[model samples]
Target: MRPISLLLILIGCLWSGGCQQTRLSFTQVETPKVPSFTAPTNAPTLAKKEFTPLAPPEVISLSDELSLHLLPGTPSKLVGIHLLAVSPDAPYENLDILHTALTQLSVKLANQRDLPCIEGLTIHPSIHGLRLSLKCPASALAQAVDILAQSWSSDAYGELELSRLKRQLALDKHIRAFNGSEIEEVWADKILGSAHPYNKALNNRELQQSLDKPQLLALLAQTKAQSQWHLLLEGVPQVDDSLREQLTASLSQLGAQQRQEERFVDTFSPYGKQLFVIDAPGTVQTQVRIGYHLPMGLADQEDSAFACEALSRWLGRSFSGRLYFDLREQRGLTYGIYGRCFNNPMARILKYYGATQQQHTGAFIRGILDHLKLAAEAPPSEAELAALKTSQFSQIALRQDDPGHRIEDYSQAIARQAGSDAMAARLKRWQTLTPEELQALAQAHFGQEPVIVIRGDLARIRPDLEEKLPEWQLKVTSVD
Candidate 1:
């Protein structure tokens, strides 16, 4: 409710007795009503997009070094250009240079374009391959493709800004210290893991020893032109005749395709029960990592990947999981802990990592190992299996509503020469897993004794650790 105010004024009469006779002047002001807002429903599930996968494009044979897979779709104005390059990890000269070049190229492409900027242009160079992914506006797709072709064809482009790359060639000491500080990363990368060609400390030695411009250039050319590469284009915009001709000419220069298989498995064997104690001075809290390598990985038996992940969740992630209860709820040793099966192209590794004080380290290790040995022999409880399935279903439901999810799956499938739907179908299999099957999976993969790594102030806890596990063989190393 609003109060109405009125005023009487005399225009041509004196203010004495004319007040009542004066004309009354007033205005009615209407108050505006506020709009009521109805909140959107917090629905449990999103309506999943109908399954519409890209029809397979004719595989273009470029050469022994290159192959192309094209996927056409109705969505307009956006395109993805993916590049996968495979090479032996030898010729460590340009390892850092590859990282430098891609970062430089990503920046160059993003800025020097009128087309929707190249977004998420990432380059991950590894021992096996370099995975490159970029999304651009459909309007500039052809231009982006031309630029990629030029990156190979031009002798000057990758090396255009040599001075800039030199600055980033060395490892940031701060980053190195930080990673070393995270004791988990150091153990996997430094102590237990295979020697990386691009190891930062090693980079300083290799970069200086092999700093030949001509040699580096030759290596880059050989990498881009001769070595095998896979190309996957998803959500490619419809091309007019002019654009089609441009693309054909641009990609054809790479010369026919040859398919290759990854038969090389990492010859890795843990040096049994060796406890590597890295000395991080002034550190009161210790980071402990324990696990062992599996002989075979997901690639060897793709069907078991889901089961591996589900088991990982049951042991580590869920509130009711073993690691959570043992490390956090019961012992109050650490805030969080993780145990998971890791898959590289060459191997699968079961790893557990967590943080704890010097006093609790002994208890944490014993508790984790007991669980590991127990899980290997026995079946998980019905409650645990239910928790694992609940997580799996939640992930499946989310993926269903995600068209991008399917697109990514299709692209990866094409790269591995696999059926796109194979990954999704495994969820159904996860539901039907019997206790025997789960136990077998655990025993088969994790039956071996693990390599334990501890990084902390060794001076503080060495006596306690030795006293706790007297029979254990412990090898101590400095974090140099």
Candidate 2:
């Protein structure tokens, strides 16, 4: 028979189970031996060097109208400059929009003039006024200064800019409507009444109506004419005679501007134990903020500075925080949680914030409240306090080399109308603060019924909140 015929016959026999007499054998392989497990050895330590503390900042009066705060360090090639324009006039509703427009105009003007040094310039609107921050090569400092000085005075306000700003604002409003990102405004209203300059809660219509070209131009002119400008130089300890002359010439225009009359009211009516639910329809995730209006501001209660810092750090230090441990690690209620104290010069508010799924909203808020109660009753252990102090010390040490952070500290001091050395004094005091003082501060401020602000699909989250937190009076509101 042919080989094919033989194979087919064998296959048919195997299928029919008729040829199961023969067995084929091959060499067997041994399994590889497993190695025994061993614990890791201790890591080698590096040699410690003697610590050299950074020199205290030197505040110099460059002219009768201008002052400079210089911090000592090995200056970097790229210097950070933080400028603040403080306006005493009534807060402009569209100052933030104007900031954006002016920044864009400045960049356009820079590109046209072939000045690439202004590449990373940024402007931020604070409660006081506009803050301009930028870093450039040391050689280009004079040009950068001129660029910033001229940006505020440029005729950048026109019909085209107004249209662009309106579009941007409209798009932002729509996004915020869906995401419920206006909780800070609610907090401001709750803590710093609606009449406060910081609490200008404008609806979409009001915002659009306030964008007239003439009004914006006038606001810009008023800002330039009345604001007091402060220039903070980082990485520049002492300017040479030539650089000093250039800086003075560039800043004299700003310094000569007339100061506006002040009109500010610090009074606030407290919202005692209220739950505000902002209805953001179709949002699957919810944003929660629980805030306490503290007894005094940082300016008034400088003694509590370290205590407030320690209490805030203990309550919500990310993975190690009490709130995070209870809400996220233990219960898987949310992704992240944090607590922060806003020590503005006039207003002091401690706030805890987090985001959670719709289903976990009630549990998350309840967990935060329960932990706050626990924190109020029991203070941090010695080990916990030690760890916080060590962390804070390390942060301070690291900030010694960072001009940006140094300038920020200086800016805060200036904003408080405290001298440049205010932060240094606070840090000096913090080094000797005892755990008993921190505990006392925590006890006095914690567990007060906080004003709760939640933004979510109210229909879905409201029922659980009512069931879990029957004591909190719930009120639903829409974004204005």
Candidate 3:
């Protein structure tokens, strides 16, 4: 049997339903054991060094954008790459170009480093340009940093790189002044209100017309003056002090102005039923996403996250999950069904999503709601609870398999103001939660009240079930 991660990747590809024919292809991949390579025997043992703590650079707090994460662990032969960019809306517009440039640069840099060991570096750019984060391993960090530093420092394409940097920096100001009226007219038209944060699709012509080198520079200066930039490093305890100093010195060269403090708003919308439809005229299949806002942070309610996860697993995760078995396995009405609950400091949102024949949209929705209602009313059977717990435990164990994951998990928890051990501790807490507690949380949060967002061929789905859905008042919104 394939490892769970590989299995999940395969399932995800199938679930998207982009492929016309389902073909099973099997390949045997070896799973390497931990502690693969040993440290050099002749390497000098350096004394553990500590530096005077410098205050974190004046930068926007991770919480203000999403959660700022920090993960620290024993030093290993891995190098991490993190990109922090500022853009008016989505960073992708610039990053797509940056990625192409970086790919070429990576190859050129690898040859220079004389290290055949370089491979598999991950780069992740965010929806909005708040930050583009990445991670390799500690062993690779020095070489990767050298390549990046040289690239940024080079004058060959310095003018062009600076131009790109300027445009990316403009995003901060645009987001700060994102008044509903202007945003709706410009960017919000392409996104459901609920998925606004994840919507990086920018009005390209409008953005390009509005942006220029002078404007970009002015915004970068403004961001720097406001002291709204900083970088973080975790893992590889040996390099923490040296890396921090090097990063601070490197960034200071940018000559960003220091600011006092930056303020952020905590906003929330009450729970209720809402619908957003995006009509794709010639599309054969519909893509639907259902999400809800949940309380933010781990400590919000006592063990609320664990309870929420348990509920999600029982109703959202497995074929055994309520929606999957009812809508896909038995009814055969949809290709896939699942749920997600993202916990953040500001709010947590739960989502149930699937794709089905446009004709079966109504039946799919009803079946999901019915399963949700049943799960809410009654606690899962002992067998169900055990299965969920086992699954959760297994997933937690799998996360530790990758050094990068460990760092990310730790970093995220710290950024969220949750302690470093929070993830592992939460797993332990979940084990002790009773089925009654899970049911009560479900009753309180699920089925009883939820603000729903549906984006699909509503014309086909709505006519059949508009009257069947409960008496709650409904508001309809169109996607242009």
Q: Per-residue lDDT of 16-53 in model 3, one digit per residue for the tens? A: 97554433221111111111123378998655422221
Question: What lDDT does each candidate get?
Answer: 0.60, 0.67, 0.50
lDDT of candidate 1 over 1-480, digit per residue (tens): 122222233432344665453331221111111112233589465454433323446566545455666665424435777666554423224555766666786777677755555645667555445566667766677777776665555453544566556556644434666766545445656433555332332344355345455655665665665345666676753445786567667766644333334344345666766687887767767888887665554455565555456567667764556787766776676788787766443444567778887777666676677677777778876665755666656665565446456445544444344554565466557768776777787787676677888888777667667765666777777544
How does model 3 fare in lDDT?
A: 0.50
| lDDT value for model 1 | 0.60
The runs of at least 3 residues in candidate 2 whose Cα sits more than 4 Å from the true structure, single-residue gaps closed, are 1-53, 72-76, 87-93, 154-160, 201-210, 255-263, 297-299
Counting only residues 3 or more apart in sequence or on different chains, how many pairs clash (N, Cα, C under 3 Å) in candidate 1? 4
Instruction: Rank by TM-score, highest first.
Output: 2, 1, 3
Q: Which candidate is the best by lDDT?
A: 2
User: On residues 162-243, what C-alpha lDDT tens digit does candidate 2 reach at each position?
Assistant: 7777777777677865455688667667766667665661343574656776766766776666566777777775788888
Supply candidate 3's per-residue lDDT for 288: 55
Tell me which residue pairs clash in candidate 2. none
**Please, what's the RMSD in Å of model 1?**
19.4
